[model samples]
Every structure is written in structure tokens, then in C-alpha cells.
Target: HMTNLAESMEADLKVHQKPSPVIVRDALGIFLSILFWSNHRPVQLDNLTEQIKTLEMKPLNLEERLEYVLKRGNTFLGFRQLNELVLEQRKLIAKR
Candidate 1:
């Protein structure tokens, strides 16, 4: 979903001939503006504000899925054992 949003915004930014801080700023502004307005827009379909129960979907054995994912590829092993580690990681990313 984040990939799709970045790609769509990149396409929107391509209308400009040159890239600069202002272009990036404007792109972010436009994106945020759309998001701000989108929340207030009327829901034109049923169950638009409904909370979906997990019971509605078929359940899976999470242990099996986690084992499969771990076996299939390399995973980021850091920040798994400690809450402080996760917060530190978030701070580093946010600083960037």
C-alpha cells in the first residue's frame, strides 16, 4: 500500500520539469490536503464505517505461517526482543 502511494505521488511530481525542495514540499502538501478532505467525504457505500470481526475470515495457524516465512527468506532479526530497541529504531528512521 505504501509502495502504491509512493508510485502515484511520484507520477504526480513528474509533471514538473525540475526537482527541488519546493516541488517535494508541494507534493507533500497536496497529498496531505487530499487525505484531510478524504476523511470528511461521505461514504457512498454500505458498511463504510463498519468494524470487521476477525471471525468473519478463515483462521490460519500463525505458527506455521511464521515458520514458512522464516524458512523462505532472510528476515530482519533486530528489534524483536526489546521494546526499547523498537523505539530506538523508530527514532533513527524518523530522524532520517
Candidate 2:
């Protein structure tokens, strides 16, 4: 669940305060996209998840991964979540 990932991310933020939050936020976004897409369109979900899992095994940068997700992510909900997370991340960085 995204919430579970968020909770873990919260802890990671406290420890690796430099880059953890956005990385975890991006990860949560990926997870949400996967679960939502899977529930809605299983075929597409299967293909995309396979690709993402492969990328997970390597050194794909977050920006590149996010761009890929932006292409595959197919709902207002996912986009909204991405926007919110990015905004919230920016606000946090601004405070630092």
C-alpha cells in the first residue's frame, strides 16, 4: 500500500534527510501507479510492472524513472498524487 510505503518513507526522511524524501516519494508513486493500474487494466499492469521491476535492478535515475512513469501512469488520481508529492517535497526543501 502507498500508506505503508509512506510510513517507511517518513522514517527514511529522518535518517537520510538529504535525498530520502523525494526518492521515497517517487517510489511510492511508482507503487501507487502499479497497484492502481493493475486493478484497472491487468494486461498493461503486467507489462509495465515487468519493466519497472527490471529497472529496479539497475541504476535508473529518479528523473528518468519518473518520466517513464509519467508516460505509463494513466489516471487523474496518479497525476494528482504526483503533483501533490512534488509540491510537498518542494515545500519541505524550501524549509531547509
Candidate 3:
């Protein structure tokens, strides 16, 4: 599943290119943390949606977003389908 998430992230970064590749690579460190040390708590999708909005409004850089996600420990819950999560989040954002 982590591989799936990583692949999805790779594809996303390739398409968006908003954050530089270096930033994306750094962000993957957070994912690695999630992969290795997470407590496996299910992250509520609603909470993640709100966090996404907050991060977008603040225009936080990737490092800040990484810290925020690490602090919240949301993605730690074995996210088996990150692609779906991303797509759902995009739809939620588009609604606004």
C-alpha cells in the first residue's frame, strides 16, 4: 500500500509541478515516517479535507505542510488508496 501511495504521489507531482521536485522529495520523508512509525489510527477524511483547505489558504510550502501533517498524524492510518483520497479531496476543493 505504501508503494501505491508513493506511486500515486509520484504521478501527482509529475502532473502538478507546482511544488518543485525537491519539495516533493522532501515531503516523501513524511510519508516514510507514516510508513514506518505510524500508530495506525484511521484518519478522518473530513478532518483531512479541512486541513487541506487550511494549508491552501495559508499557501504553506511543502515543508510546512509536511510538518502540519506530521503533527496531526492523519495519514498514518494505513492509507491503502491514496489516489482515491486525492481525487476525493480534489472534488471537495473544486466544490468551493
Q: Clashes in each model (backbone N, CA, C under 3 Å)?
A: 0, 0, 0
- lDDT, candidates in the order shown: 0.31, 0.45, 0.40
Alpha-carbon RMSD of each model: 17.5, 12.8, 14.1
Query: What 10-residue stretch in candidate 3 is worst by lDDT?
Result: 73-82
Query: Top TM-score: which candidate number?
Result: 2
- TM-score of every candidate relative to the true structure: 0.25, 0.29, 0.24
Per-residue alpha-carbon lDDT of candidate 3 for residues 1-96, written as tens digits (9 for 90 to 100): 445545654555567533334434444454433422232333333555444343432222434443554443223231223323334334544555
Give the C-alpha miss distance for residue 85 in model 1, angstroms: 28
Q: Model 1: per-residue lDDT, tens digit, 1-96?
A: 323433443454466322334433343334323322334443222332141111122113423332332242122221121212223333544554
Put the candidates in TM-score order, highest first.
2, 1, 3
**Clash pairs, model 1 backbone:** none
Which of the numbered candidates is closest to the native, going by highest lDDT?
2
Model 1, which residues run further than 4 Å from truth?
1-18, 41-96
Query: How are the candidates ranked when ordered by lDDT, highest leading?
Result: 2, 3, 1
Lowest lDDT block of 10, candidate 2: 54-63
